[model samples]
Target: MLLNNRIKAFVELGKFLKQFKSTGYEKVNTVLYNDDFFDEMILKINTAEHHNGWFTKENVVFAIEQWADALSEKNLKEWLSSYQLDTIPCKTIGIVMAGNIPLVGFHDFLCVLISGCKVLVKQSSNDDQLLPFLTSYLVSIAPELNESITFTKENFKDFDAIIATGSNNTARYFEYYFGNVPNIIRKNRNSVAILTGTETREELEALGEDIFRYYGLGCRNVSKLMVPQQYNFDSFFEAIYPFNIIINGNKYANNYDYNKAVYLMSNYKLLENGFLMLKEDKSYSSPIATLFYETYTSKETLLTTLEKDEEKIQCIVGNNITPTNIDFGTTQKPKLTDYADGIDIIQFLSKIK
Candidate 1:
């Protein structure tokens, strides 16, 4: 399919996705697919928990709405314009997707297809349903994509290049297996917030969205906090109190209860607001229901430390910390160009032999 055709297909798919969100799922005739297919999609979204407990309807819908906003004509054109789109020899790119959050690997799948290449996807068993269902919608809108997209459960072979997302441990395995090919292997990275204690309640509340959204399962979620030594948690706790509803989910409550108990038993100091727990630690990857915090003695020293450990950070969210940092509440809603691990996927694909 032509590049413009591919963009149009996704734009249509975005419109189809916009109909499904936390508010509820509604089928509009704007999509090319019939009601039966749309109904099946609704069923899948509703029952996604059976496949993976984290794929709750609310989280899935939030993901869909975000993608719908990102796949607009303006966003697509602007993002693609930054790259050289001249067609390369259409190679098959194998993608091993991560399932931490809903549609976490969709961007890679979209990138390979838009670069005029076929994508062979090996989806994490945790997230097998949503992407394939969306892919089916894309095929219906543009049948040409039927040839371009493949989801495999078997061991990967025949693909020329690969993109894989996993933990640091699996990354070693990915390197061992796909090392010969031009590839992008991603590992775990967590976002952190640098707070100066001067942020307004609204800003801190927005930061809560970055923290609590998707139940902190995404790489973009803020898992750590950097604050002044004597920083007070009163405003932070009050601002984020609205997100307390997250504890209503049994799975999340279980995690909160377990982690809280573990911390108390270990004699660790904790700051809790009944729902979320804040603990003083230096780790970037905090457990679910808990956030690790560190007191930064000085901005200069913290910057030096972060500069040295850039590889471990996915996003640095703050106000006036640096122009490069993402604004609060916006980490989870990444644009198409916000490549994971800071790797330019299209550039890598374009250079693939």
Candidate 2:
């Protein structure tokens, strides 16, 4: 298939995804595929919770809507325009996906097929249903793409390159196993927010979304806060109180109960507001229903520390804190160009041959 055909198919997939949102799922005439696909998708969206307890309807729909907005012609063109697409040679690329958040590995899948290569995907068992269904819809829009896409449960073979996402331990295995292949091996990274004690109530509230969305499972979710010394938690706690209903889910509430008990037993001083817990810690990755915080003495000192630890960080959210920082609450809605780990995927794929 040609580049434009691939773009058209994804654009159509985006149109198909636009109908799903946190509010509800609605079928629209603009979707190019058959009614059967529309019906199947509706069923999948409804039953996503059964597949994975964390895959609630609201989170699944949020993921769908974000992708729907991203797959536009303008966005696709602008993201792909930086590379020389015609010079790329077709090859088979293997993808090992992560299921932390809905459609977490779709970008790699998109990059491989959009760059005129075949994709063999091995999905995380936690998130096996959604991507394959979407790929089927893409094939319906461009039947020629059928030969370029494959989903495998067996060992990965017959591929020229690979892109894999996993935790720090698994990444070491990936590095040793696929070390010889042209590959992008991703590991555990967490996002953080830097607060200078000058943020507005609105920005702090927006920061709540960054911390709570997807129940704080995604790499983009703000698991840690970098704050100035003497920062007050009164307003921070008030601003994020609106998200307290997150505790209604059994898995999240259970985690909160367990972690809170452990803290109390260890006599660790902590703060809580019924639903979420705030602990003073130095770690970037926090548990469910918990947010870790660290205090900094000076901006220069903090920046120097962060610069040295860039590999462990996925995104930094704040206002004017860093030149590369994402605005508060927008981390979950990453642009097509917001490559994870700051790696240019198209640039990676273009050189695969």
Candidate 3:
């Protein structure tokens, strides 16, 4: 299929996705193939938690909503505008998806197809439902794509290159196994926030969205904080109080209770609201229901530390703290060009032999 035709198909898919959002689902008769795929989409979104406890209905719908906004014709064109799509060579790309959050690997899937290459996906068993069904919808919109997408459980073979996301250990395995081929192997990375003691209450509240969304499972979620010395926690706690309802989820509550109990038993000092715990630590990756924070005496020292550990960080959220820092609460709402791990998949694919 021509690149424009592929883009049009995804634009249609985005319109179809727009009907299912966090607020509610609204059927749009103009959307193609809704009669056949709409109800099933609802069913999948509703039951996603049964397959993976973390895939709650609200979180799934929110993810869908983000994708709906991202796949617009204007956004897609702008994202791809710099690339010379016609000059790119076509090859079968193997993608090993991580299922920590809903549709986490969809970007890689979209990139391969949009660049006019075939995709072979090995989906994490934890998140295997939604993407395949969506692929069916895309195929209906553009039958030519039927030959371009494939999902598999068996070992990948006959693919020209690989893109894999996993923990540090699995990344090593990927490097060893897919070493001979062109590949983009990703390891564990977490996002953090830098608080200068001058942020508005609104910005702090927005930071709560970054922390609580997806129950803090995504790489983009802020798992840690960098605050100035002796920064007060009272305003921060008050701003984030609205999100305390997250503890009502049994799995989340269980984690909170268990982690809190363990900390208390170990005689660890903690700062906590009723629902969330704050701990003093130097790590970027914090456990569930907890946010690790460290105090920095100077901005220059902190920036040097962040630059030294750049690969371990996915995003740095703050008000102009860094040239590329994301705004508070927008970590989960990544643009198409905000490539993961700061590696551009389009550029990588363009040079595949």
Q: Which ten residues in a row have the lowest lDDT in candidate 1?
A: 29-38
Better of 2 and 3 by TM-score: 3
Q: Number of backbone collisions per candidate, in order?
A: 0, 0, 0
Models ranked on TM-score: 3, 2, 1
Estimate the TM-score for candidate 2.
Answer: 0.98
Candidate maximizing TM-score:
3
TM-score versus the correct structure, for each prediction: 0.97, 0.98, 0.99
Model 1, stretches more than 4 Å misplaced? none
Residue 96 displacement (Å), model 1: 0.4
lDDT for each residue of candidate 2 in 264-345, tens digit (9 for 90 to 100): 9999999889999889998899999989999999889999989988999999999888889989989999999899899987
Best by lDDT: 3
lDDT of 1 by residue, 8-39 (tens): 99998888887887777777876666574778
lDDT for position 301 in model 3: 91
